[model samples]
Structure formats: structure tokens, C-alpha cells
Target: MAEHGWLFWALTSAVFAALTAIFAKVGLQGIDSDFATFIRTLVIVAALALFLSYSGKWQNPATLSVKNWGFLVLSGLATGASWLAYFKALQLGDASKVAPVDKFSLVLVALMAVIFLKERPSAQEWLGIVFVASGVLLLALRR
Candidate 1:
């Protein structure tokens, strides 16, 4: 099971992401999306803090390499921007439509990995990416 941990976690993430769209759509009612995103961020930060503390995984940030800090900071910025945009989109659009479009990130990530990480996806994997991209286009361009 441990060897297949990534599969399990990836499925779990998808479940939670589905829930996130539903919950965020409802929660956005009568509130500014930016404030809602801030509240969500605070909750996530507190929950992760507690989880790390309970799991004894807390580490000194000062000990990390500069490269680690740099990339982590960049990743955090990207995540913040993504969350802000997602929340706003959910506020304005149908969650069913918005979430699928947001998942176009899957195709973007595969392309980025190939370009920046020099990752070589097998033909089968490329086919999957193409399918996902096509699906996203279908959802996004539909009337």
C-alpha cells in the first residue's frame, strides 16, 4: 500500500478538491471572495500547524538551503494567487464550469514539466494529457 501511496493521495486530493468547489460556492454567498479566501487560508495555516506539531514534523526554517527557501516562497506565492483567482471565479461563475476550467492546470503542468523539468512523458501519458486538454476546452467553450 505504501508503494501506491501517491495514487491514494492523489485520489484523496481529487475528492477534497471536489468538495472544495461545492463548499466554496456555498460559502461565497453574501461575502467578498477575497475575504473568504483569507479566512480559508488562515484556517489552513492553523490546521497544518497543528498537524505538523502533532506529527513532530516541525523544522527550523533557518536551516533550509537558500534554494529551498526561494522555491518554497515562489510556490507559496503561486498558491496564494491561484486561491485568490479560484475564489473569485467561483464567486462569479457556476462551480461546475469553473472547476473544470481550473483543472486545465493539469495540462499546463504536464507541459511545464516537460519544458522546465525535462520530463519525458510516454506516448500514453501524452495521450492522456491531450484528452484532458480537449475536455477542458469542451467545458470552457460550451455555451
Candidate 2:
């Protein structure tokens, strides 16, 4: 059960992601997307801080190695950029369209994992990635 824990968490993340798009779209009305993203980031930070404290999971930042800090900072920057772009898209486009197009990251991640991480996905996984890429193309191309 513990080995399959990731599957449960991944599904939960998907549900939250779907809700995030819907809620962000509605909240973005009459607001600057960058400002909205900042507000969202603040809420996330506060929530995580509280959760970490309550769960006794808070760790001393100074204990982390340089490599851990560097990669985490890079990941944070990437996440911030992604959220800003996603919020801007949601503000300008239909949520239904913007969300699916944003999910194109799935295909990009798989390809990047193969190239950079040297992780070879099984053929079945590659097939799914190809289908996801095709679907993203279908969503992105002008009809």
C-alpha cells in the first residue's frame, strides 16, 4: 500500500489542479494576472507553513545542502513562472481551453525526463505520452 501511495497522491493532485484552474479563472476577473499569482503564492506559502508546523515536518533550511537549495530555488522559479503564465492565459482565454493546453506540460515533462534524467519510459508509457501530445496539438491548433 505504501508503494502505491504515489498513485493516490497523484490523483488527489489532479483533482486540486482542476479546481485551481476553475477557481483562478473566476478570481482573475478585473485583476492583473501577476497580482493574482502573487496572492495565490502567498496563500500557498501560508497554508504550507501552517501544515508543516502542525505536522511537525518543518526542517531547518540551513541543514539542506547547496545542491538541494539550488535545485529547489530553480524549481520554485519555474513554478512561479508557470503559474504566472497559466493565470494570464486563464484571464485571456476560456478556462476549458486554457487548462487543457497547459497540460501540454505533461508531454514536455516526459520528453525532458527521457533526455535529461535518462529515464527510459516503457513503450506503453511512450504511447500514452504520444497520445497526450496529439491531444494537446488538437487543443492548441486553431480550428
Candidate 3:
């Protein structure tokens, strides 16, 4: 378990992400997706702030390097945008369909890592990506 700690965390992330789609879809009813995203972001910030302060880890954030800030800000923006689109899609589509399409980003991430991060995926990883891509396409096709 210690050696595969990351795998455990990744699996936990997938479970929570699946729950997120179901919960968000239900919550989006009678609410604007953008407003819902804003509310969710506020909740996340509050939770993180409370955890950081409780753990006495809330050091001066100003000490972070400019490069760190730049990347973090960009990442936050990307997250917000992704959430917005996901919420909107969930509002308009079935969770079963929307979730697979959204998760197709996993395949995109693998390709982007190879091209931009110069990280080469093993053949098995590539095969898994292909399977995910195929599943996404099948899920997306009109019945």
C-alpha cells in the first residue's frame, strides 16, 4: 500500500469524481450552472482554509514564488472553466453520457503529457488510453 499510495489516491479521486457528477447534476436543477460553480468554489475555499488553519499550516502565502503563483492561478482558471462546462453539460444532458465525455479528458491528458511534458507512456498505458477513448466515443454516439 505504501508503494502504491498514489494509485490508492487516484482511485479515491475517481470515486469522488463519480459522486460529484451525480450530486452536481441533482443540485443543478433550478440553479444556474455558473452560480452553482461559484457556490461550490466558495465551499471548497472555506473547507481548505479551515483545514489549513486547523493544522496550523496557514503560513504567509505571499512567500510563494511568482512562478508558483502563475501556474496555480492558471490551474485555478482552468478548473473553474472545466467546472462551468461540466455543470452546464450535466444540467442539459444525462449524467451517464456527460460524465464519460468529460472524462475523455483523461485520454487528452495522456497525449498532452507525451507532447508537452515529454513524458512517454508505456504501451499498456497507451492501450488503456485507447480503450478509454473508444468507450467515450461509443457512449457519445446517438442511439
Candidate 4:
């Protein structure tokens, strides 16, 4: 691991992502999904700008390679789409249930990466994914 420890960043991101769902669930209580997404994005944009200013690391990209531009735009759109749908889900169900179902996308991505990307996982990783799927399934049986 690097001196800063990538695991710390990963865990921080995970916790923030979970809390984002909770906040969106509460904040979007009476708003339409589209409007909620707009509100969230605007606020996030302002926050990002402020943080960049404070950190003195803001940069203007005057040139981008075609491939890099394509990847960046596609990734940004995919992320926005996910946030939109996730907030909608959070709005409609219990936070615990909605969060688990949304998180199942992780398992879905793992499977899809194997099938489409030809990515392989270790035996233990496969077992852990299977457990994740089973637990998610069991959640549906709860009253």
C-alpha cells in the first residue's frame, strides 16, 4: 500500500457514498427525481469548486485526447445516471432495503465484468460475491 494507504481512501469513499444515499433519501422527500438530481448536482458542483479553490489545485484542461475525452464524458454521464436512479430508489423504499438493492449493482458489475470484460476473480472473491447475492435475496423475504 502507498504511504497514504489506498484502503483509507476506498473506505472513506464507501462511507460517504452510503451517507449520500441517506441524505438524498431525506432531502428528496417531496421532490421529483429529475429535480432532486439537479439540486444535488448543483450543490455538488459548488462544493467541488470551493474545495478546489481552497486546495489551490484547480486546472483548466485546454487539450484532451479523443480517447480520454470520450472516456471522461462517458464516465461522467454513467455516474450521473447512477446517482439519479439511486436517489429515486432511496426515495421509494426503506433506506436499509434500498441501499442493499442498489449496492447489489456491485455484484452485477462483478458478474458482468467476468462475462463481458473477461475479468477473473479469485475463488474467495467469487464466494464472497455469492454470499452478497444470497443475503440480498434474503432481504426481500423480510416483512
Best model number under TM-score: 1
**Residue lDDT tens for model 4, 54-108:** 9998876757688988999998999899988887877778888877777788799
| Clashing pairs counted in every model | 0, 0, 0, 0
Q: Rate the local accuracy (lDDT) of all candidates.
A: 0.97, 0.94, 0.95, 0.86
Once model 1 is optimally superposed onto the true structure by TM-score, how far is the C-alpha of residue 130 displaced, in angstroms? 0.6
Residue-wise lDDT of candidate 2 within 1-143, one digit each (tens)? 99999999999999999999999999999999999999999999999999998999989899999999999999999999999999999999988889889999998999899999999999999999999988888887756
Whole-model lDDT, model 4: 0.86
For residues 1-143, what per-residue lDDT tens digits would candidate 1 score against the true structure? Answer: 88999999999999999999999999999999999999999999999999999999999999999999999999999999999999999999999899999999999999999999999999999999999999988998889
Which rank order by lDDT, best down to worst?
Answer: 1, 3, 2, 4
TM-score of each: 0.97, 0.96, 0.95, 0.86
RMSD of each: 0.9, 1.0, 1.1, 2.1
Considering only N, C-alpha and C atoms within 3 Å, which residue pairs clash in candidate 3?
none
Q: Report the C-alpha displacement of residue 4, candidate 1, in angstroms.
A: 2.3
Q: Mind sharing the TM-score for model 1? A: 0.97
For model 4 the TM-score comes to: 0.86
Task: State which candidate, 1 or 4, has the greater TM-score.
Answer: 1
Q: Summarize candidate 3's per-residue lDDT along 1-143 as a digit string, tens digits.
A: 79999998999999999999999999999999999999999999999999998999887878999998999999999999999999999999999999999999999999999998999999999999999999999998857
For this target, which candidate reaches the highest lDDT against the unseen true structure?
1
Per-residue error at 31 for model 3, in Å?
A: 1.3
Candidate 1 contains a number of clashing pairs equal to 0
